[model samples]
Target: MEDPYEILGVKRDASTEEIRSAYRKLAKLHHPDLNPGKKEAEDRFKAVSAAYDLLSDPEKRGRFDRGEIDASGQERPPERQFYRDFGEGPGGQKYRAGAHFDQEDLSSIFEQAFRQRGGPGAGGHRSFNMRGADAHYGLSVSFLDAASGAKRRLTLPDGQMLDVNIPAGLQSGQVLRLAGKGMPGYGDGEAGDALIEITVEPHAFFERDGNNVRLILPVTLKEAVLGAKVEVPTVKGPVHLTIPPNSTSGTKLRLKGRGIRGADQYVELKVALPTEEEIELETFLKNWEPKHPFDPRKHMRGR
Candidate 1:
């Protein structure tokens, strides 16, 4: 294994927060869900995971820093050996070479050799029980799907289809964990979980701010000057809205419970005029002037 600092792209004297930030960045980048069927990215993900596993543990990190263990967790002396043998049978039949010991046999051998030294198998040789590997997946959702809460079908690594319920207001980068949905267990141990990361697509006309949805509505000059009932667009549908008499160009109007998840939000109205017809409208405006014209810049002359 390579150095944890190098894998995370941090300096050796980096703080815990810096290391954690780097790890999160790399984890999101090389995650298997983002890069499927890419062996290079998978290898990089494994390397990052291994580095984080070691550095996040205080005891293991101390031992590694003291040179007591190498990057792969082997002891300094590396107390492991391999032997091969080939011999002819009694009836002149040649025998092919093969591995001779299973995991249990190796465990027994190690237990006998290091029982007094308090190794991992000091308390007699026992069968290993390990959890399955955790699975990762990425899910893409539409803007409405994220806001309204929808159900989706997710296929597991073992060819199992799962029904996933996406919660309301689901944002990008949010992770959902499904228990016992990963690889199969080795023995009686439980299976690992499956993690799903969400990626919400951008909407053309709507934007979310916290739990509310924002939109810009365009209104004609006549609608702004004289009170009128006009149709306005909402996430649900279009509805009739009443514009106040003599409303300003930048007036904001509120449509209760029409935003995401029936949340309260406001729609800003911008008054627009037809540039080609402005000359004809100016002649009408000159003939019909209000008796009391309100000057918006009355209080700014002295300041």
Candidate 2:
């Protein structure tokens, strides 16, 4: 794995704001929604996020810098460093791999290993000094609820209920962390955090386009032929839109600030021909013909 500082483009001693700014900038640039189907960007985004997670936490960062843990957050085993020391016995005695020893290093390792394994030591007592594992949960939310913010009460597996705050403009699959709400800590350790992955339900009429909302509006033949004002559905509610005269199908109109975060809601017009069978309308259409020969697709040469 690349160094966390290099991935975040910050110095090892960077300030909190500097680290935060770097992370935010990179996150926005490499967000999956912004760069869809970009595998390289997605991979980099994951790496960057992991790096930020490690560096952002003061304790983890300290451990990483001090060589106590690896970049992947796994605790480094001290056996290798102490192997040479424990290889030789007190009087230059050589102990091969898997060989038992009674040296100080071997005794320390055995004591810690036995304690972790829940085995009673010479004192015939089990002791635990560790933090509890973080808990994970899932939450379902509506598209609008994700666009706008909402609060929900969720019951965890442990029967603990937590009030989750859904942030505005949060994307699907994003996690909402509730600190100290996970499994209780061991002994006097701090409680683990609760991580809730947000699942935003798809909307029926509205489609998400980055920060914008997209919708298809059907217009009548007369409305398309001549300019008309029509009501269009938006997240904020229905609003009147002015369609230009002689507007063709696939014409788009932008309703400014109608989407989340002040994004414009784009409406594409689809001209629908009338299906009502009226003798008067048929007779009028037969009598009224184009003044000149016109072909809408005259420029097309081949399919």
Candidate 3:
């Protein structure tokens, strides 16, 4: 894989928001739905997703920046190390055996140390192989992304960038499992998995109600009273909706299939009065009396 920052088209010091913004733009452009049967687009999409997976994470990004890991999130062979980082030792001590000792030599040394302490199993032989512990993590997605489906990159604790598939209509606080994304297994043992919890962020202009998207649309008082064909916003786009004559605020209008698949968008009308700048309107209203005697608030208290 290419350098993660290069793949995401971001600087090494880019913020999390910048990384996410780049990922969303690239992923949307090359989404399989937009380009069918195109291998190159699919490949680039995957690469971009993988890159975002690494650079979006602070820990993995730091590791990559410090040269402890590569773009693929694999740990580089240490320049120098001792066995204590991986396991226990006598007197909880540290060693500087370095590259001078081979794997077999280290195993022999550990075996001798264990034998000196009378190892656990029968005949004083300790169990050498054990599976690593599973890890847990959290991932956040946008409201639209959660509703429309998306692919995201998660950074594992060990500096791995994992590609996560988010299903459409995914709710908040959901759990996703990634096999072998957790801690590395011990000798001859299988690596553990990672469990990721999903968090969905709130939208500024859209509210989700089951399969529907609710939006409040404001219109001029003239448009509401005289009735007009006005453009209303939906998740997909804006559409012209006819307002019936004498329609008041709190009126509901539905646009079918404009939300999630098989879902609708519900628009609520809010009639806005003219501001002080429109003095003519205030004068006309002061001199003109209602031709039709109707009490809209007759049902309210103190009417």
TM-score of each: 0.61, 0.59, 0.55
**What is candidate 3's local distance difference test score?**
0.74
* Model 3: residue 295 alpha-carbon error in angstroms: 2.0
Clashes of 2: 1
Candidate lDDT values, in order:
0.71, 0.78, 0.74
Q: Which stretches of candidate 3 lie over 4 Å from their true place?
A: 1-130
- Could you report the Cα RMSD, in angstroms, for every candidate shown? 9.6, 11.6, 10.7
Return the lDDT, model 2, position 267: 93
| TM-score head-to-head 2 vs 3, winner | 2
Residue 246's lDDT within candidate 2 is 88
Q: Per-residue lDDT tens digits of candidate 3, residues 1-303? A: 589888878887888878877876777676555677787877777677667667766777898899888887766654443344544446855554453567987776666555544455335547545455455455779988888889998643233578999988887767787887766776666886776768789988899998788998888888888999988776666898888887789999888888876699888899887665888887897899887878877889575
Ranking by TM-score: 1, 2, 3
Tens digits of lDDT, candidate 2, 1-303: 688899989999998769867876786677665676787877777677667767877888898998877876666776665676467777887767777555975667767765654656665555665565455455678988888789988754333468999877898869888898865776677887877767788988889999999998889878998889999888777899999998988999999999988888999999987787878878998898877868889789586
* Residue pairs clashing, model 1: none
Q: Candidate 2's error at 253, in angstroms?
A: 0.7
What residue runs in model 2 are displaced by over 4 Å at the alpha carbon?
1-127
- The alpha-carbon deviation from the true structure for residue 219 of candidate 2, after best TM-score superposition, in angstroms, is 1.3
